[model samples]
Target chain A: MDKPALAAWLGAEITGMALLSGGAIQQNWALDVLAGGQAQRWVLRTDAAATLAVSRSRAEEFHLLRAAHAAGVTVPEPLRLCTDRSVIGAPFFIMRRVDGLAAAHRVVRSETLAGGRQALVAALGRELARIHSIVPPRADLPFLGEPASDPCRRFVAAMRVLLDAGRLPRPMLEWGLRQLEISAPPPAATVLCHNDFRTGNYMATEAGISGILDWEFAAWGDPHEDIGWLCARCWRFGGPGEVGGVGPRAPFVAAYEAASGRRVDPARVAWWEIAAAIRWAVVAIDQAERHISGAEPSLELALTGHIVPELELDVMRAVMARAA
Target chain B: MSWDGHEAPDTRALLEIARTTLMEAVIPALTGDARFKALMVANAMAIARREDGPAAAAVHAAVRELGDVAALCAAIRAGAHDPGSADHDRIAASLRALAEARCRISAPKALG
Candidate 1:
């Protein structure tokens, strides 16, 4: 990672550095440094060799994190951003490291954590509310572009383009998109939608959630999309909890409503849940293509393709269940 | 591998044995990310074995009965099977059946 150059940039002595495993699109390193004789632990996030088409750059993510933090969302404090590629061979951002496990299965079943399940869900609800408070027209987030008049339709259109670009035809996904297209909901209030908000993305400890992570996919869209992405069954990770595989939907929605001062819409969230499934399927295929095309060549990426069938079935089931 | 009956093992036999060894012996001894990678390897092998096996005949017939997937895809995008269309329900049913067939191979546990 060119530790010497990084140490020079930070004006610190590197005590230790190691690559942390996780985040397929971005590589994270546990970076410990001694600056001014004060020790600090930080995580350096940088672009991987290959990344998903939708992922934002490190600088953009740093801005998003700054906006979230300014909005009072619990997130790892984004410390510094380096856009120069020569710093570490890629643009990178370093954030203060927060302690806790972000694993979905363990977080769902955790007993040592204080405040139990409902409290944690409520915390996340408030966190999401705070995030959604960041609307468009911000000079800081100019890269988010103009807010879409109809984010749902735009999403389906974008997915169609991506699907057509894919190697094989996905009739199931096409069918799902067709259903979503016909039932496209009226545009709700535009807010910062955490496009990847789901289980296993946040760190939790005995005290509760330490920080909400993974903001690279943040965009200006219907806030219900974030809610649906959180409550999506596929993100449930085999856990029964409806909210990020941790708690029920009612409490989370209630908490969000109380925090956001916006009425929670069940139907819109349901629609976004279908969108979430299709999005996951498309991204999974893209990730697997990285392996199958010999770009990534990792076992994890190969196994991800196997997840598409389950996603296809989920979309079909949702379509049939909601069919007139 | 060819199935010449000299017991050199065909693809299915090879994957099953290799995955069994990986799961039963190798995975038990590994730890952390290595263990996770090994498990994924085992799962990939299992999926490969399933893919090598016969796919659902009904799925093949469904593809033949409905249009080819590419035609079906274009037909869908063109609103040929939109709601209130004559062939909407039939096409939806066929799509669901095909999705289930895929589930049977890639993730049988996902099938209801």
Candidate 2:
């Protein structure tokens, strides 16, 4: 579709257009518009020409945003969803623009941002707690409810399927299965978990966290799963300290504990951290497959293959450390 | 051996060329592509730069360390120092301790 046509369809003056990023499923843009003679910036997310297999539909993603936002999680509000392919040649959605940075390397390296890292991390923990506090059975979201009985067992089984299909390293797969068998956490209160809770998935301002992004993987699970995922070393971007590379583990856990009135167990957290590494390793291998199959052929996907072994090593090291 | 001794170009050098081509050629032509495709290209370039630079050495060193740990575990299993009865748990624990120490001294550095 032409720019003029899109402008007419959106019913706003397109002042400036900047391409944000592209993935397998969608193209994101920072659309600067003059609406009612007032300048505003909004995010334009549209589907790719070649559809992706794993992406949720635009309507589903919008519904998830509304549900999560109404549950008091910090997420960008949905402005409008356009499913008319005639307008833009694909489905798209518009959301209120969120202000803050998402670059992981910049967050770790900028000395100016260093002081606020701890507070931001603490806020992240508290906000994650709030997200996990949502009662999935009561919510009207699509991907709610636990997966059968014994989520860990089912999770391990799913990983095994990926392992079999992807031909992942036997040692890492074996080690992960062994660890899961030995150190299964007792069941806890279930809630809506932002499965992709990590540093890059959040937008932060000096004041605090502004919004959480990426709800495609959100589901109902043990809340500590989110906590362990946040504190995982792979997501820390090499920053010193455990709390998402911002600071030590104690403060982040203390903040979460204070917010949710639950004790943070180091052993359980370590187990989940190991699980996080294994999960990332599996995803990295899958990304590599996507590149190899020419589904994406992205340098990110190619390089992701290299990180799997490192993650395996981390998983082994974490498990071993805890056993000691 | 010389730095260029290998017959095939090293992984780092190959990734460097790919990264350069992507940044200089591919990115400019990606303007009309969908947003997801453009983001993938950008992320690919970023990852390529990292792989061609510091990440190569980091991964190489890590692999070597893991190899060493495996060798140590084999030795312990073969009755060489007993590693306190030499169970899988004991071997894993010892390796973890070693890795933790290394992480303390040389934490993974960020991509600049």
Candidate 3:
């Protein structure tokens, strides 16, 4: 935004900066700088003008990145956080730039990028395990508030509020919530979960994961959620492999279990998978509502609503399987 | 383009033609983001075309007869239509049927 002021703040000569294509939630700029005659490449992340409700703020995300990076989670090395609005008009953070394919389709299909399917899947499982290694009640991540006492029921309650607010009644989502509410799991230990742990969110070169890119949705939740999210059908990009369309569920869970030293429960993961479907359905409707209500007229958002039926179908199948 | 009932193509037919042209001719020439946008346009056209006619309308009527979505959802939440109850099966069936109808228009491949 304000290049001169940013340069002064960093005390580095800004050679070039260009906005990256992704990050609808946040605006990412690929930046190059010459600091003390040393060339450096980095990415700057800042909040978009119209922010979504669920994601953490730039300041909060910085804390999350710090914690995640500290815990050995494969994330971009969070370098500096500029909180002064005057420097760039909004809070922004800079991190090391990672090069790899993060596109969902490409990441799922590319032989070169994904490396070996089992190896990559195992690596991702280990990455998720590292993310979950960061337990709650940490002083650094105070912005996350408190861990959900019962993440499943908490999600169901929140989804009900959102579904009602949608105005256009979604019976399918309601049904799924009803099923989820009754089947709420007993409270267990909470861990820091990457709520959006799916294919497109992480970058990898060959078989080695460069970094986990999206951190805005990181919060204290059930570890199974991140697991289910990774295994969620909607996130598969039509690839048949169970783990982000990369491999089967058994090895992924085995890897997570071996890495995290926590028992991986298939039933709990199944329940959260339903929650994931409902969660995406709610978000898809909300995104589409932005277009439908004329708040944001974009073809992408408009077509997002059409995806609800498929997600709803997913919910029904999963919920029914969990039924009496 | 008169509505003179003299072999006039319906709106659904027009949308089908547009989507077919987009998929077969126009979209093949597009790449990257432009191609993605064209695919979305084609998908929207297909959805709109399928949403027309009595088959789609009949689903609304059937679901309405079962009850509005809100009431049905409320009933579900209250546990009035418990799992094995007659009303549970009926309501679930109706909702499933409605969802399937929506899939027919929005994402038929997703149904199977």
List, residue by residue over B1-112, the lDDT tens digit for candidate 3.
5577656487988888878888999999999889988988988888888889665886677677666667777888887776877777767767777777778778899877
The best candidate by lDDT is: 1
lDDT per residue for candidate 2 within A114-187, as digits (tens), equals 24756766777688777866765664664554444565666676776777676433354446555675567777
lDDT of each: 0.88, 0.68, 0.85
Best of the two (1, 3) by TM-score: 1
Sort the candidates on TM-score, descending order: 1, 3, 2
**lDDT tens digits by residue: candidate 2, B9-35:** 666667667767766776676664454
DockQ for every model, please: 0.83, 0.14, 0.73
Clashing pairs in 1: none
- TM-score, every prediction: 0.95, 0.75, 0.95
Instruction: Name the better of 1 and 2 by DockQ.
Output: 1
Q: What tens digits encode model 3's per-residue C-alpha lDDT throughout A1-324?
A: 889999999889999999986555799999999988999999999988779988888988888888889999888899999889989899999998988888888778865565678878888889999998999689998888988888888898899999888868788888888887877789787999989889999999984899897888888899999888889899999876888887777777778889999998888988888889999999999999989999889888999999999898888777766663
> Hey, what RMSD does candidate 2 come out at?
7.2
Q: Write down the worst ten-residue block by lDDT for model 3 chain A.
A: A110-119
The TM-score obtained by model 1 is: 0.95
Worst 10 residues of 1 chain A by lDDT: A108-117
Best by DockQ: 1
